[model samples]
Target: MVVKMNLKHVDELSGGRKRFRRRYPKSLVPVLGEAVFQVAMKAREGGALVSEWESLMKTYDRNVAKAERAAGVAGADDRLSPLELWREARRDAAAMLAAFKDDLTEDERRELLGDELERREADPVLYRAVVEPDAPEPKPTLLDAKNMYLQERLEGGTGRNNKNRLDRVCKRIEATLGPLNKLSLVDLTRDQARTLRDAMLSTRKADGTRLAPASVRRELDMIKAMVSLGIKEFGLQREADNPFIDLPISSKGVAPDVDSSKRDPLPKNVLLAMRDRMREKAQVPALGLIWRLLEGTGCRGAEVVGLRREDVVLDGLYPHINVAWHEDRRVKTKASIRSVPLVGDALVAAREALTLSEGEPMLFPKYARENGPDAASAALMKHLRTVTKNPRHVVYSLRHNMKDWLVLAGTSERVENRIMGHTVGGLGDRVYGGNDAKLKVAYEAMEKAIKGMP
Candidate 1:
């Protein structure tokens, strides 16, 4: 007589063989790649079969647990809403019926579908899910909008800074509004926008100070741009106006020129002192050249740090540095793409830097990668601190110092704007001159500025 041992998911087969079989959860089938798992068992004795079954059960449990964790991490549940799952199941069922109908006779197709229909009938939710139609596509959330915005905007190879800014804004918004993925764009309201702005305003920095108004303004602007892009791109219609647009942010108690007010131009004595320190042989040659370039050309710290070997024109009629955008680095603005004539100490520094570069693509290879300008600024700031203890006297003070010298030397506003890469407002200012004419005026003004420098 055969003794039948009832075991969960273990079936007794022909010739005393046993097979371990289990079905994955419907939700996990896509992740696990199959509906059922089956493995043959070689053990024949009742005790041996039981032991093998226990081991197989443990292994299967582990696999299922791993798959569940993976599914959760992939946000499968979030993407596979009941409606989505229904749509997918309907498509799969139709495809299966069509395929089998082509290969099998009418009786076979009917038999297979009969089994499926019985299973569906057993679970009313499954039956409804499979039969339900015309479910709208999932509404896009803030996270979705942010992702799409980054994809489209960052495709052009610029916008790294913008991307970082947008990420920071999203993080702050989510902190107040909960998970961005859960906050649908259509549901966003002006009250929520005001709440976020107030929260940001109240937010304190690590240094125990409230967030700067300018920084708050920028974050708000970033959110506005993101929402505007999302509405336009997705063609989302809303009953209410975009909450982020025209949001009033009080600039009370904030200076109009907060950034400019924070930094003061280096005094003539301080400038001479820093120059003397950089002249020391023990000083870093590349840093010294970068400093000279900033002082002499009045170019922004990034433009000076991001210069390539080819950008430094040593043999030109007017030896100058081209501050144009390259694949490796970006210019600050359209006006920033002009050439800066090398005059006085800048000429000497560029020549030395060119030789030191040794034909490398970047003039300052140490500071030409991502965030290279920031690195260069930090290093220069550290060096500057050693010369002066004033909080207002920074590496960027050199630009202000050069501006002062240009003004004192009686350079025209156009010449000053050209050399400093400031935006020339009118069409006349922008369209008047060609490269050589601009360079000639810029070189003369820069020469006067350096001569007048104490």
Candidate 2:
């Protein structure tokens, strides 16, 4: 007699044991590596058996969903070129072989190899074509290069904005060069690079204003970096033949004022005026404090706004903020990871901001989420507009202003570099000093700059 457990896919076996069995979808069989999944349930208790069955069901569902997503990404291989098809087949075959090897015992492995050898001997030509054809590997397309670049870069903890920017750059590049899937990296040419440069310059926004040379330059720089990465990673091309490298933005057909747009350092008087205005009318108390921190420390806006409570070390011998990478935010570069001494107004602001934090994890809780720093910047820019009408005077200009302050204070370039988180001199400069020595020098330079601030 058969007993019913009332659970789907769970069956009572002859020896009073229950088993769970489910078949994978036909399309997903290759991805899941099996047509059916089965496991024996040793527990006879109803609750335990149900729990085991449910757990197995969840695992099956998750595997199926994951396989479906991967299959979607891969799409049909019918449209692929012969070389691309061969590469895909080779990768899939290798993955299947590895998985098969992992699951089998030594005896089973030997049996499998012997059977495969007999089949190979029966049809040598077909075996060679399927398993070991002597064809050159397919060159990676632009899309493939982009995927590989992003995979490696994102693994190193790049932030969301940077990833978004790379995506935008790739989209723009695709628009000019053609679909990335069809455009092989090896086929990219200098003429195409020039055309892309010219296209970006001529492109206009909804307001009918042409793209700035600086903006175009930044996009081109991104392209160059991507191509450079692709070339190095895949051995596709040499540095000398990189199409995107040193492609000058010709001004022959562009408007005269496109290149003139740039951020200028905020004058001392304007900086003071803005500080006073923020004091009187700023809505967010934390924003005002963030501004003062930026003014005093000369840090990037994101660095100041994205600070966590733990990053602010006011109790140390040198009260400073640790600018480092966290899950919520990423520093600009390796050099950007440094301790910034809190001097003058910055110290007062940090203390006040800490008090206002009220034991929250982030110093500025409202601006600690994704794209939080960007929001803070927009709000600060609104306030900055009231103080100065100059289009060039931006939030970043405060950093430039601090550089000038350090210069006027007679600080050495190395000291200023430490204070501002810029890349220090050569290898000797980096290797010779410990963190303590670097912090001491940075503190002195920052103190001088703050004191000398007009």
lDDT of model 2, residue 241: 57
Give one digit per residue, the lDDT tens place, for model 2 in 2-119: 2123567877777778888889899889987889988888765333554566568767865675566456645333234334445645554445455663678645654564468456
Root-mean-square deviation of every model: 16.2, 12.3
- Highest-scoring model, TM-score: 1
TM-score per prediction, in order, is: 0.71, 0.64
Candidate 2 global Cα RMSD? 12.3
Model 1 shows how many backbone clashes?
0
TM-score of 1: 0.71
Per-residue lDDT of candidate 1, residues 101-155 (tens digit) = 2678655664666578676553333334334434464576776678667656543
Residue 276 Cα positional deviation in candidate 1, in Å, after optimal superposition: 3.8
lDDT of each: 0.75, 0.75
